[model samples]
Target: MFAKVIVDISHESIDKCFTYRVPTDFSLSVGDPVLIPFGRGKKKGYVIGIEELADFPEEKIKDILSPLEKEFSVEKQLLDLAIWMAEEYGTTLNQCLKTVLPVKKKTKNRTKPGKIQYGNPYPAPKLNAEQEEVLFAMQEYFQEEKVPSALLFGVTGSGKTELYLRLIEDCLSKGKEVIYLIPEISLSHQSRMRVEGRFPGQVAV
Candidate 1:
């Protein structure tokens, strides 16, 4: 595998990644800091990506020397989240990384959250024929291990939340956790109330 490393350089090149071949038997992750051959000397770089093929010629590509700053080894998911934030907020990667992980400080270990408990969920109300059809199709998707994305389009007060509550109950019954994100803060109160009304203590917000 080859790693795409963003070398620590400032002149004529910023936010550019250099491709380097990964050594066999070395476990390289997305956010690992490593030493690599750059120019006529070695330099420290962050591993941003890993791929099967090398971007440069096979002979020209250099192997990553070793991992650096083991204490600061970032999580793959954290790095991925930083990348997403960078793209989402139109900011630099460095800025996003700093926001997520402050330098020189070890973050406390967090316990994994348990599966959400949708206690005695409220039964879904009777639905119109159209709504029933939509609910049936969506439920069928969950029969398989992989579920596809679904879009629900309707006018306001068209029982969209009812459909959602039904699905949430179904998922929780099958030991699946759900994460519902509210894009706007203003919408939080209403959405949270609705979800809490249906599932009780299952909601964090």
Candidate 2:
């Protein structure tokens, strides 16, 4: 038996689906991670399909080495989405997957002691009638199945950050992840400090 594996070469190069002969005792499945040799070096890829090709010469094909992952890292729907993205963006499926998946990192797990303390524990200023109405509207909008993109149009000292903090707190209470994007590096550092002070180990910059 032979399997067709899609291998990601490089960002600048296109991915190629190569057919490799599977050993009789080999146990392989679609989406199983496998290591295979390319032009000069070995690379990681995934098995997409399996079939017996009669036209190809048997001696030219290579055999798949041991698999990297025991199971598929992606689900079927997400895999289809990645394939569509690869075609639409003129990029390889591997690159599309890399962009969608979060970067895995090995970090020490440190549990924080007791209650977290915030340096700026100032109470949020009272919202005006207009602000209160806007907030209520936003709450309703977010309650829909999909969240629509929103723009906070306000000048300086408009209490935008305070509202953001309240939303973050609500999300945290529900066990959700929050990502904060800031334009300035200094502002990001300050925001990180404030979030860390409020949520301790739960908040990651």
Candidate 3:
């Protein structure tokens, strides 16, 4: 039995869905990356879905190449979120998906791992009384039942970065993922460098 599979197209194109025929022996699933012919060339994209169709002629569609990705790249919850974003932002689902996915970076140094490395080998400073109180508060908030958002408002040079690092460390120790946001590109770069230095090969900016 043949199935229709939808894939994303490259080149910042809005018309990203291209349907291909799933082979009889192939057991394909959503989120798998496949290479398929597009116009005169070929491109890589994730399999958005598969549908069984009874009426369409099978000879009209093309076959899918070997999938590049082992698992579904897009989670279902994230897909729902993307759909919501598309409706709210007046954009297509393909555009929203492109925005969420990481950009593919070409590299000559294939041996290097694609992760941030933190090499800060110096000792950390001792926490003051106020710093300790804030750290405790953060821990307490994390332990609560409700999802919480925090605003760290303080004057410049008030050790905000230090507090953030400690909070990140706490999250990591509890096997949680953390996303840090910065308002300025310069500050983002600085924070990325600091995280890379302290947690080499485990971070991504």
Runs of candidate 2 with Cα error greater than 4 angstroms are 49-59, 70-72, 108-139, 142-205
What residue pairs are clashing in model 2?
Answer: none
Against the reference, the lDDT scores of all candidates come to 0.75, 0.69, 0.66
TM-score of each: 0.45, 0.54, 0.68
**Candidate 3 similarity to native, TM-score:** 0.68
Better TM-score candidate (1, 3): 3
lDDT of 1 by residue, 45-154 (tens): 78898999876689988889987866366577668877898789776676666555534643354445742223334545789999999999889977887767778898
Predicted structure 3: clash tally: 11
Better of 2 and 3 by lDDT: 2
Model 2, 153-194: lDDT tens per residue?
A: 778877677667767777778776676667787786567656
lDDT of 3: 0.66
List model 3 lDDT by residue over 1-205, tens digit each.
Answer: 4333334642335434666877776766666667777668876666766777634566777788666664346665556666677779777776666665545664353334654434444245688898888888887887877866888777998777788888888888888766666788768656766776766555644
How many residue pairs collide in each prediction? 0, 0, 11
lDDT of 3 at 191: 76
For every candidate in turn, the CA RMSD to the true structure comes to 8.9, 6.3, 5.2
